[model samples]
Target: MTPLIQRILLATDGSAYAARAEGYALFLASTWGAGLDVLSVLEFPPGMNPAYPINDVYLGQLRKEADRHLGRLADRASQIGLSVRKQVEIGIPSEKIIAVAREHGDDLVVVGTHGRTGLEHVLLGSTAERVIRGAPCPVLAVRGIKAEAVESAAASVPLAVRRMLVPIDFSDCSLDALEYAVQVAKQLDAAVTILYIMEPVAYGLDFTLSHPSELEAKRARLGDRLRDLTAAVTGCGLQADEVLRGGLPADSILDYAHSQAVDLIVMGTHGRRGISHLVNGSVTEAVLRRADCPVLTVRSPKFAPDHRRVIRKPEPAASSG
Candidate 1:
């Protein structure tokens, strides 16, 4: 499993979405004992030329304004009893936010998306999507109102993360995600369900050949992986369960999560491959598109490796020449 989140970066722009991101970040900080770093970028006003030198008076005034904006976040965070550090940056919004995340060695980046649609999204891609594609660590996209308000308004909430769903393909990246999920579950006194999808079964295979026993064997293998994952956090004290489904990976994951009312989904994006890498793949892209719950995606390096896993690059089946 991946390491617990110790440092988190919240990219804010004074938008309601940014505030929402801040709220989620604060909640996570409280849950994991993580440090919150809030950032806001300073952009030149419209029609202003970067090459032109501006008056010192205007520069001072602008910096003061930016400071006030960021100060509000700190104040709110403090009031909520969440420890926070904030900064005001001057550069492109997405770039500056990414650079700050890189500098801080943050394990998670939380950002709110305004849910842009149609031509607007086509013309100006989402900052949240950009960061997700480029970030070195996991990114949580919080939607709707800031989750803090939701949590506060609903006190006596008995369901404090009881079930976590993690979709794995026996890959190192997926194992890393599983580890991360286990750590979170431990903190919340929750249980986890490790899910694996048998892709070929999606096509309705019914073969009683020499490999008739392979299906059961594969199920047993998945069971072993689940055991090993939970073993790492057994002492930390969290119940772990396993589920194996046969069908499309994304569909299976989504159906299971909804059916089980999973609190969260911890997944790993293996840095996309080939030309398709230019865009998010079908499975991940699909999950992110319609998932009602929060989705945590881990990139490379921070992801843990599974010792019992072996990934042999698929060999193209021979053509009937």
Candidate 2:
């Protein structure tokens, strides 16, 4: 049987945000019974202080710091009875992160929004963003959790994946993500919420000019499709529901996720071979950047062995409402 996630690689730079991501990666590794590789890259020579300079001694110190971070993560993984390994690399953070993930055949790469080198501090030119753009597998970009929020709850209790959100546009890439999310929900006993934006321009007229009957008919067809898909998931013994809204897709997604307190947002992306969705202002990229919770981006199955992933397309985007 194809496991949902056989291997997980976590890229950390020992920042507080990275620590938060480590907790999540460790939790997921334990839950999925997957091997965890905790990787830390020493992006020295630039972020290093002028006093430290670029000498062998400073390089050694950087390696030691990276090891210190990996050691902490590996210890936690071991305590949880997880199979964990540690990796320390020397290079640019994003390049090394993608290279390590590719070398290890990691099914998922977890990263904090900001790295030790502050590559992810700015969303556009950040290390985490670059990794998301080029990683070989699914990328989980996690932002730092509020300390007050963690403290108010029983923070020691492991984080849960109770609610998952998947935004679909009836595209192949989106279906690939839905399949991945379904497997995860089944494994973790999480409920899923599928979001579909209702665009009225398909009728060749603006929303204001569309006839009420046209609008009603459009809703009926989309609702049927949504129900069919949601039922397909529930048929697998997993709970699922659908939401249909009319507005900008990304804004609607973020609003619903926040109001509903979704734990994870799973969206689809075309492979790295194409022009990046980032340049095209993709809804998936927008949600990834602004979602209140963690966002998991999955590409199509071209990169791996397929397990009968025959995704039924509702219709083509140009024609589908």
Q: Model 2: per-residue lDDT, tens digit, 81-190?
A: 99888988777889999999889989899998854444443466688778888998889888765444544443576689999999887777888888888888887999
TM-score of each: 0.72, 0.85
- As a whole number from 0 to 100, the lDDT of residue 150 in candidate 2 is 44
lDDT per residue (tens digit) for residues 263-302 in model 1:
7777877622333345545466557655666777766435
Give the whole-model CA lDDT for all candidates, comma-separated.
0.67, 0.79
Question: Candidate 1: where are CA atoms >4 Å away?
Answer: 1-3, 42-48, 51-69, 115-125, 145-160, 202-213, 231-236, 271-282, 301-321
User: Clashes in model 1: which pairs?
Assistant: 1-179
Clashing pairs in 2: 119-127
